[model samples]
Target: MTTAATTETSAITETAALQDRLDFYWSGRAAEYHAHQVSGARAAIDRELWASVFATALDGCGREGSGALDILDVGTGSGYLASLLADAGHRVTGVDHSPGMVSAAQAAHPDLRVLIGDAHAPGILASSLDAVVNRYVLWTLPDPVAAARAWRTLLRPGGTVVAVDATWFPHGVDPAMKVPSADGEDAFVRTYDPATLGALPLGTAASMEDFAEVFLVAGFTDVIVKPLPQVAELDLRFGVAPGHESRPHFVVTARCP
Candidate 1:
């Protein structure tokens, strides 16, 4: 085989391996993930903030005499966001790549539907959704721009896409140090190594402008970026470590036009 073919094959193998590792990691921590999200005063505050962000985005989608809005929560580990939206009268479906995570979500919210699927390629019909919401998912994705483009295709005209994330680890931090886990499993988890963590295309390093640009390139309009004040306050009050306190978290919203 040619060198190009060999490189392509290697890349595919690496991608698959990385995905497998992530699947196993999340699967093992499903219960811990849900518990962290729903427990504690800080968790309650974060949920309210997330709900407000998503609720506002969904409301902007407009009913147009239609029934409830159809919302898809990509990477909906444990269905936290899905349940919140469902309770708010929206038709919610959650998709996760990890089978264990999906099972946990289904068990937690039997009323809500959660499926095992890749967030980057959620196999849903085009233009079938009114909104797609994700929280702390971008960092884990290998190709966020591709995922954003896919999300745009999933929404109908005037539909919205909302992503909530933060820069969990800044540039200077030692990757080996105890960093707050985005998966909600632990207050602090040890990293693999500096090289591995540094090589990751983390959303944490991407600024608000970076996210807005991706959405704009993906055919979205009315992009809005804002910080979650409540979340920032809660972080300061309940931060586990020095750098973890009041980390730069923001909510990005864009409309499919």
Candidate 2:
């Protein structure tokens, strides 16, 4: 009825539409994306670094004392990180919004139970998880702040959240082009819709502090951040996915309070 109400409603509708488009886009690219992720995971140096991070996270979250964790891997494209967590002796359940990605993950690791689910609203029971983890998924969220809040609710009290992401679009987004293989270079708009970039508040965050603040606002405590120059090194040695630029990634962890 009011002008302000109409504007707010329109913005919400538009953002939801944009998120649907993003899911479709990523689903279509699952094969290409999985190929890229496998290359990165196959790098021994990077694998070692991530393994160490997860090991430290398990200890930091008191998993070592409590026993293996019931970890939910949100936005688990291709179950790459899920496998790593399984290797760490955790009971891992993964959720992703993209069917194609779910299929890819299942195909790659038939043992992993990855379901079609949204990161912002995973539908997991409240306080049922010992940990929530993701990699490179936060930046793509239409609402990272809300997603962080939801993740906090999914974890039990004293349970921890571990996520790794980077400044992938610090200078703002460029059109993501489709590729044939891991190295295809044809230019086309597929990764993000420029008009919707504004809706993603953390999509182009300049620093790790921007990400850390989300959990802090969500009532998480004991937040810790560590820079991953090792990721940059992996990119330097093995090269990044086509259309992606290399930057230092960071692992941020926080405990539910």
* Residue range 129-243, candidate 2, lDDT tens digits: 8999999898888888889899989888889999999877777666554455322343224445555556678777899998988888888999988898877877887787776
Give candidate 2's whole-model lDDT. Answer: 0.81
**Candidate 1 collision pairs:** none
The candidate that wins on lDDT is: 2
Model 2 residue pairs with clashes:
none
For residue 47, give model 2's deviation from the true position in Å. 2.5
lDDT values, one for every candidate? 0.77, 0.81
| After superposition, candidate 2 runs with Cα above 4 Å error | 3-9, 39-42, 62-66, 175-191
TM-score of each: 0.86, 0.89
Candidate 2 lowest-lDDT run of ten: 181-190
